[model samples]
Target: MSTQTASSIEIEAFEPHPGWARQGRQPRIAIIGAGMSGIAAVVKLRRAGYTDLTVFEKADRVGGTWRENHYPGLSCDVPSYWYSFTFAKNPDWSHRFAYGPEIQAYMERTARDFGVLDVTHFDTPVTELRYEAPTWRLTTGRGDEHVFDVVISATGVLHHPAFPDIPGLDSFEGEAFHSARWNDDLDLAGKRVGIIGTGSTAAQIVGEIGPEVGRMSVFQRTPQWMAPLPQKAYSKAWKRFLRLFPFVQTLLYHFYYWYMTSRVGGAVLGDEKAHARLAEACRRNLAENVHDPELRARLTPDYKAACKRIVVASDFYPAICADNAELVTDAIERIEPGGVRTKDGRLHELDVLVLATGFDPTRFILPTKVTGENGVDLEKRWDDAPRAHRSMSVPGFPNLWMIEGPTGPVGNLSLITISEYQLGYVIQCLDKMKRDGLEAIAAREEAFDAYNAYLREGLKKTIWVTGGCHSWYIDKTGMPNLYPYAPQQFRKEMQRPDFSEYRLIHEV
Candidate 1:
């Protein structure tokens, strides 16, 4: 039995079953996590008449990233109306941007309402997932094995913590933890705190805890685009109006999609006038919040706006300018028994060190071994540079689909929106398999390569590529790992499943 290349394999068409006229066989489906992607899959699957589905979540709780990262003042950067699922809406969001707890509760409630809670296998993580010819066999962390006809890789990026490899980091005398794994039992009241990495996470953490700490020393590598967040509690009258007029809420949701993609994304791509205009707005916002020239300069980003993720914080600038706060721009040399030592030959002493260091955004799947045809490992196949056709399927891997594949979340649009679009596309592919009695489906390598090449070509003019900042959106080669297109473009791309570029493998 010799193995075959994806292009060389031949898939024969089978005649329909006599009973097929009555009903089609529902494929056994397994979703990896219960996060937003997984939950979206479960909800949509059930709606599409897919009952044989199970969601395996490693954690005991339902909220994926939100449940993990509970640092000070954690919240969704996007508005709550736009950030929610298509099937559910929270009209009573206390603020425009929902906090971590509220987002987690929303996820929990969505799971409950969608009946995904009962189908979810809690505390069960897939230790190994491999494709066996026509089906996928998954092994749980508990050492149990199960087979499924289709597997959706929905365990998205941003879960794994990327800790800096500073010298003597392990020997830190004080309590140190990543913002993703925030320390709750240990109080930082009146304690000198040192926060590292001034990215999106760092901005929120600093704003939330700066007023309470005795002293805050923020170590920065590069400045990010900081914009003012008009975060405020909803007025009672407004909330009541939103609840009464549900269409108004729906309209608001669509408006955000347009605003973030067309308005914000257009500014970054070939719109020089708009780019300068938005940049001026951010600079003015920074000036109004931070009075000190030095502090304001330090807060200002040299990169173009929307290069890295723009930090939306109302208090982060003011927090850094506070008398008890000190922003350290020098490179970190090492960690000592007392605190961090910088290249400036100064030891920034601290009682607690908060690593606001963001996750390895490129690494979408961690700790999961995915093997495809001929025992080709997915990680080895990617070779540090991951690629997928339309951020969904790969060539060698059949009957497997990635929810938010490489460069999947490049656009500033809501990730939930992206997940559903991909879900809908994959479901159509699976339905074709069920209707046609096909055993395997793999994307053509030529198609995959073509899509990525087009993405790279388009990225050359975008802020993430041309802008001076090095963000997680790009790979080591400086080529973007994201799609580098507007949300509307992506939606248009996934609006239909093009089978011309795929190898539909029918069972012999």
Candidate 2:
């Protein structure tokens, strides 16, 4: 974070969109998850004059992953300036990359400040969502059923833990937990810890506790593209300048936004030379951190860069190379009574086993039984792969818009920004519905097919599929789940909503 002075400018109040509020009769809206996306959905809906909004957050708190996953050294990879909501620009962020606790607090404050808590239902989990003609019936975990005119799915993809099914995992007597389901009570100051998976979560955990632990064994399946994190504390004076001068905050956001999109984003967009250059940089960083050539080779990836999620951390390389830490590249044979067995017949003992295995990205919305027209279950329909028109709606699912559907992992951009744009698209649809006196609306089947077709063609052009690597981004059917265009191009497409592409009707 730079300590330069910012020019003070006059700040103006933000106004609600024109005709955003309902006219004669308001529609009842229920938003499924109050995480970043759900919070964005509700915040935008409220600002648009949609007073009848209910945000259902399963956890007692407002933040999603930020609230649930209390893993050590938990911080966002994206810069703090770009990660926050555009409407609620936070100028007092302590670090360049805000950690989990501060971010959760920020979201909670935003909810309270925006009057979202008034209509939000905390500790309420929507068990099932059914669309009966014009209304959506949502059944909660408490057996309470509520009906709404529209159902917005803001439940994030990475909220659920995806544990690997190693043999004898259940028989392990040692204390074990997923990174998302971290046992806060379990102390690991001087205990032996075995963490499975070298993803971002485990990378962060290793950096935090590697120095403190007696012995640390890091299990790796595939090495991620690790990069340096330039995080620094912002001075009080700089924060004051940011707070006093809103334009400076805006400028900072833009700076990070363009910088990230150019480096990593360019690599994903089929730039193999860019990928090789980044790979060399990562190799150099690894070499500088780890003196042993063999250990460095184990840390390197055989696959190309930008194939999987790029993990950013300054201390990861050093953590793994710590005197007490061991990087195990061997494939897991099975789980023993007290430790894990590798293919090389090595039984690593451990007191606490942490599975940082990432979430089920393919599981679009699990455990939520969604029945649309003709009793077509959303879960059953999209079992193999999920699809949505403009990453929002389907042909059978009426008045239902899913944020961050299959068509978006939003490579190389802040997820909050992509989510805000997605919510903007959904809100436009809601505005059209209220203004046109529409009873129900669904994306035309032809439009859905056409969009996915375009997406399929674009995925083949990207490095995710062409590059020699497999991840949650690619579905079972070889369909990569990233937005099928450049970051800026996708934003341009989202800015304009074409109702002609959707089957907007007064009655279904």
The local lDDT score (0 to 100) that residue 289 gets in candidate 2 is 83
lDDT of 2 by residue, 95-132 (tens): 99999989988988887777666666776788998877
TM-score for each model: 0.94, 0.93
- Candidate 2, superposed: residue stretches over 4 Å from native: 1-23, 272-277
Task: Find the 10 residues in a row with the least total lDDT in model 1.
Answer: 1-10
Instruction: Write model 1 residue lDDT over 1-508, tens digit each, in one string.
Output: 1111222322222222322212466677889888899999998988888887877888886888988889988988888899989789788899988999889888888888777776777777888888877778888887877777788988887888999989989878999999999878988889999999988899999999999999999999898888788787998899899889999999999988877776666776767776787788788888788888887787778888888877888878889988999999999999999999998899999899999888876666657888999999988888868888888888998888989888775556788898999999988887777777677789999998888888889889888877788777788876687777766788888878899889988762
Query: What TM-score would candidate 1 get against the native?
Result: 0.94
Per-model lDDT: 0.82, 0.81
What TM-score number comes out for model 2? 0.93
RMSD of 2: 6.8
